[model samples]
Target: MTLDTKKNAFIELGKFLSQFSEKDTIKKKDIVENDLGPLNPTLSQVFFEEFQNLIHLSQSHNGWYTPEQVYFSVQSWSEALTEDNLNQWVGAYDLSAVQPKNIALILAGNIPLVGFHDFLSVLIAGHNVLVKTSSNDQHLLPFLSKCIIAIEPKFANKITFVEGKLENFDAVIATGSNNSARYFDYYFKDKPSIIRKNRNSIAVLNGQETTEQLAALGEDIFRYFGLGCRNVSKIFVPKGYSFVPFFEAIFKYQDVIHYEKYANNYDYNKAVFLMSNFKLLDNGFLTLKEDASYGSPISSVFYEFYENLPDLQTRLQSEGEQIQCIVSNNLVENSIPFGQTQQPKLGDYADNVDTIRFLITIK
Candidate 1:
C-alpha cells in the first residue's frame, strides 16, 4: 500500500472512534458497559472501522502506544518490504535465511487486547498463528478476528485461536513475566523466537514538571487501572519532592477508586502500608509510597527520589535490561520522552522492536 493510502485508512479509523466521544463519557455505568462491551465490539460498526485502523495503524510501542502511532504503522507497513530496511525487517540472520512454517504466540493478559498486534503481524506476514491468549483477556480477540473475516474474509483461516500448543509451529514469540521468561527460554531454546519477558517501565520526574504534566502522568500510571506492565508502576523523583501537588493534579481519577478491582487493591495496599508504617498521601483514591517495587500496588503505585541525575543514572543503569524505557527530560542523545514522562511516541519499544514489521517478515 502507498503511504498515503495507509495514512488515510487510519484517519478513517480515528474518525470512527469519534462516536464514543458523543456518548456519556463521565457516566460510571457507561464506562463500565463500554469497557466491557463496545470497548471490544468486533462486529459493531464502530469497532469494525477502528480494528482496520488498529491493524493498519498499529499501536504497540515503548508502552501502550498512542493512537497516532498506530495510524503511522499502517502507512509505513509496505516500506518494510523494501531492501534498505529488509535486514531489520527480517532480523539478524546467519547461514541461510529462512521462514517458519508456523508461529506460536503466548500473549500476556494484563492489558486490554495485549496480544492483538502479534496476531495481526503473524497473519499479515503470511504465517499461521497458534494463539494461546491469556485467559484473563480471552473475550475480545476471537471476536476481533471474526470481525476481520467479515471485512477481508480471506484472512479468516490464517489466524487461529486455541488453548494448547501447536508442536508443528516452527517458531515462537512469547510474552510473559520474568519468571515465565526463564521457562520460555529453556522450553523454546531450539526454535528461533522473540520472547518478551517482564520489564518495569519508569517515570523520571524533574522538579520542573508542570501541573499538566502530573495530570498526564496519571494516564500513564492508571490507563488500565495500573494492571499493564507498561503502566508506570514506579517513578523517580527529585529530592524533597512534594506528593501533595502531584496527587492534587492527578486527583481527577478519584472516580477510579470506586472500581471494584481497583478499590480492592487500594484497600489491600493501604492496610499493608499502615501495618508497615509507610508514609502515604492519600487523596481518597491513589497513594504514593517511596521505596516500593514494581507490581506492588493497584490504585496506588511506588516512587523513589534521587539526589541528582548522576545518581539516578547509576541506579537506572543497574536496572537497564529489566527496564523498557526511562521517561525523563533528557534520555541521552537518541532517547525519547513524551511531554513530561507521559505517553511514548511511535518506535520507543523495548529492544527497539518494530513488532508489526517483524510479523510481516515471517515469510
Candidate 2:
C-alpha cells in the first residue's frame, strides 16, 4: 500500500475515535474524502456501540483501566492522529525504501493503549504486525484494529493478533518488566528487536514553582493511578524543601484513595515502611518517602534532596537507563513540562530509541 493510503487509513481511524468520550460523545456524521468514503453509517454505529462496550468491559477486566483513563487514552490518540501531526511525524524518515517485514509486538498492560504506538508504527511502515496483547489489556486494541480494518479492508491482512508462541516474524518489539526483559533479550537475541524494561519518570521541583504548576504536576504523578512509566514516580527537591505546598497541590487527587487496589497498596506499603522505621511524609492519601530508588510503589512517591544541580544532572545521566522521562519547569535538562509526560508526541519513542528508524532498517 502507498504511504498516503496508510496515512489516510489512520486518519479515518482517528475520526472514528473522536466520536467517543467519557463526557459527551459526538453524534455520527458523514465524513467525505476519507478512505472509507461517505462514512459507512452502519459500520459507524457498530463501531461506536462496540467502543462503548469495550470501555465498560475494560474496567471489569482490569480494575486499573478505569473508564476515565481509557477515555483519556482515546482522546490522546485522536489528537495525535490528525493529518498534520501524522504527516509531520512521519515526514522525518524516508520509509519508501523499507521492505515490509513481519514485526511481532509483545505489549504491556500497565495502562490503556500502551502498545498502540508500536502497532501503528509497524503498519504505517508497510509491515505486517503480529500483536500479542497483554491479557490485562486485550480488548481496546483489538476493537481499534477492527475499526482500522473497517476503514481500510486491506489492513486486515496487515494486522494479526496472536495467542500462542510468536513465530514467523522477522523482528520483535517487546514491552515488559525488568525481569521479563531478560527473557526477551535472550529469546530474541538473534533477531532484530527492541526489548523495553521498567523505567520510571521523575520530577525535579524547584522551591520557586507556583502552586498552579505544582498542582499540574499532580496530573503527571496520578494519571493512570501512577502505573505508566511516564508517570512521575519520584521527585528531586533542594535541601530542606517543604512538603506542605506539594501536598496541598496534589490534594485534588485524594479521591484515588477510594480505589481498593490503590488503597490496599498505600496501607500495605505504609505499614511496611513504618514497621521498618523509614521516615515518611504522609498527607492522608499519598506518601512521600526519602529514598534513592527511582521505582516507587503505588500511592507513594520516592524523593531525594539535591545539593547541586550539576551533580544531580550527572547522576541522572549515569542512571539514564533507569529513567524514562523527567517532569519539571525547566529545572532539569530535557525535562518535560509538568503534567505532559503522558501526552507523548509521535517522535517521543520509548527508551529514546527511534522506532521508525529501527523499522526502516529492519532487513
Candidate 3:
C-alpha cells in the first residue's frame, strides 16, 4: 500500500461508512439491550457524528499528527500508513535484523472501535494481530475488521482474535487500567510489550474559552460519563473562575445520562456529598463539585479549583504520569476540543501510539 494507494482506499472506506448514516440498524443492539433505550432524533445525530468524525480524522489527519513533535518516529510511521505511501514504505524495515516476527495487540474497550488502529498497524506491517477485544466493545472490533476485509479481502487471513494463548505472540501491545497492567506484567513476562495502564486526562483552562468552547468541553466531560482515557476529568482555571457556562453546556446531557446504573452512582455520590457537608451547585439535574480524584463521579462531574498557575502546575506535575491527553482551547500544551470530547480528529491515535508505525514495525 503506497501512500497514494492507501489514501485512495481510505477514501473509499470513508464513503462506504457514510452509508450507515440513516440506517437504524447501527444502534439495533443498543436499543434492544436497553443500553440506549429509546433513540431520539437529536441523540441519533450525536451518535452518527461520532463515527463520521473518527473516520474522517483517521483519514485526513494521518491519524492526527502530534504537533508537539513528541512522537517523531511514530509520526513517520503514521505518514506511511496513509494511502499515499504505504506501498513504498512496506517491507522498508529490516525485519530480519529484528527479533519479533508476529505482533500481539491487546485491545481496550473503553471507547468504540479503539483497537482498529492497532489492527491496521499489524496488517499493514505484514505481521499478525492477536486481538483481544474489550468485553464492552466486542461489537465494533469485528465490524471494523469486516470493513477492512471488504476493502482488501486478503487481509482477513493476517488478523486473528486471541482468547487465551499469548506466548505465541512475538511482541505485545496492551491497554488497561493501572491495576490490570500489574496483572499483565505478571502474566506476560519478558515478551517485549507496550503496556498502557490507567491515566487521567485533563484540560488546561486559561478561562478565556468562548460559549461554544465551554459547551463542547462539557460534552467531553459528560460524554460517556468521563469513562474514557481522553475524558477531561479536571480543569486548570485561573483565580476567581465561574463555572456557570460549563454547567449550562453540560446540562443538556443530564436527561440522557439516565441509566439506572449510572443514576445510582450519581445519587450515591450526591448523598455522600450532602452527608460530608460538601456544597453542590445543582441547576435542576447535574451537580458540580470539587473533587480530588480524576475518575468521573457517578451522578455528576467533579473538579478541583486552583487560584494560581504555579500551585496547579505543581499538583498536576506530581500526578503527571497518570495524565493522558490534555484538551485546551488553544491553550499552551493541550489538545483542543472541536465539537465533542469523545469525538477525536481523523488522525488521532491513543496514548500517542502510532497505529501506522505499529503496523509496519514488525514487518
Candidate 4:
C-alpha cells in the first residue's frame, strides 16, 4: 500500500476513536463514519458498539484497567492519529528505500493500548504486522485493528493476530517485564528486534513550581493507576524540600484512592512499610516514602534528596536505560513538561528508540 493510503486510513481511524470520550462510554452515533470515509458504515456501527462493550469488559478482565483509564487511552490516541500529526511524523523519514517486512509484536498488558504505537509504526512503514496480544489487554487493540481493516481493506492482508507461538516474521518488537525481556533476547537473538523491559519514569522538583503545575504533576503520577512505564513512580527534590504543598496541590485527585483495587494496594503497602520501620509521609490516600528505588508499588511514590543539580543530572544520564521519560518544569535537561508524560506524540518512541527508523533500516 502507498504511504498516503496508509496515512488516510489511520486518520479515519482517529475520527472513529474521537466519538468516544474518557468521561464515559456513552456512544455518539451522530459523528457518522462517512466523515471518516470508511468503506463499510454498517460494519463500522457494529464495531462502534463493540468498542463500548470492550471498554466495559476490559475492567472485568483486569481490575486495574478501569473504564475511565481505557477511555483516556482512547482519547489520547484519537488526538494523536490526525492527518497533520501523522504526516509530520512520517515526513521525517525517507520511505523510498523501504521494503515491507513481517514485524511481530508481543504486547504488554500493563495499560490499555500500550502496544498500539508499534502496530501503527509497522503499518505506516508499509509492512505487515503479526500481533500477539496480552491476555490482559486482548480485547481493545484487536477490536481497533479490525476497525482499521474495515476502513481500508488493504490492511486485511497486512495484519494478522496470532494466538500461539509467533513464527514466519522477519523482525520482532516485544514488551514485558525484565525477566521476559531476557527470554525475548535469547529467543529472537538472530532477528532484528526491539526487546523492551521494565522501566520507570521520575520527576524532579526544584521547590519553585506553581500549585497548578504541581496539580498537573498528580495526573502524571496517578494516570492509569500508575501502571504505565511512563508513569512517574519517583520524584527527586532538593534537601529539606517540604511535601506539604505538594500534597495540598494534589488533593483534587483524592478520589483515586476510593477505587477498591487502589485502596487495597495502599493499605497493604502501608502496613508492610510500617512493620519494616520505613519513614513515610502520608496524606490519607497515598504515601510518600524516602527511598532510592525507581519502581514503586501501586499507591506509593518513592522520593529522594538531591543536593546538587549537576550531580543529579549526571546520575540520571548514566542510568538512562533504566528510566523511560522524566517529568518536570524544565528543572533538568531533556525532562518532559509535567502532565504530558502519558500523552506521547507519534514521534515519542518508547525507550527513546526510533521505532520508525528501526523499521526503515531493517533488512
Candidate 4 lDDT score relative to the true structure: 0.91
**Runs off by more than 4 Å, candidate 4:** 24-44
Worst 10 residues of 4 by lDDT: 31-40
Error of 4 at 201 (Å): 0.6
Q: In candidate 4, how many Å is residue 316 off?
A: 0.6
* TM-score between model 2 and native: 0.97
Query: Tens digit of lDDT per residue, candidate 2, span 1-363?
Result: 899999998997887778779998774665421223454646545556767878878889999998999999999998999999999999998998888899999999999999999999999988999999999998899988987887788998989999999999999999999999999999999999999999999999878889989998999999999999999999999999998999998899999999888899999999999999999999988989999999999999999999988999999999999999998888789998888998999999999999999999998
Residue-by-residue lDDT tens digits, candidate 1, 1-363: 222332233233223333222121121222211232543664344444455444333224223233433333222332322333433433342313334358888888776566766775565455678888886656546655564454444556667787775577777889988889999999999987788877766788776777887787777777767666666778888889877777888878788876666788889989999899988777888877876475556777778877778776876777676766656556432333533222333333444576655554555
| Angstrom error at residue 10, model 1 | 8.7
Worst 10 residues of 2 by lDDT: 30-39
- The top-ranked prediction according to TM-score is 2
Tens-digit per-residue lDDT, 57-86, candidate 3: 432333111111112212223343444344
TM-score: the better of candidates 2 and 3: 2
- Predicted structure 1, TM vs. truth: 0.72
Worst 10 contiguous positions by lDDT, candidate 1: 24-33
The runs of at least 3 residues in candidate 1 whose Cα sits more than 4 Å from the true structure, single-residue gaps closed, are 1-100, 331-346, 354-363
RMSD of 3: 10.6
How high is the CA lDDT of each candidate model?
A: 0.60, 0.90, 0.58, 0.91
lDDT string for model 4 (1-363, tens) is 788989988998898888788664455655444234555546645667777878888899998898899889999999999999998999999997888899999999999999999999999998899999998888888888878886788899999999999999999999999999999999999999999998999999989999998999999999998999999999999999999999999999999989999999999999999999999999988899999999999999999999999999999999999999998888788899989999999999999999999999899
TM-scores of the models, in the order given:
0.72, 0.97, 0.72, 0.96
The 10-residue segment of model 3 with minimum total lDDT is: 63-72
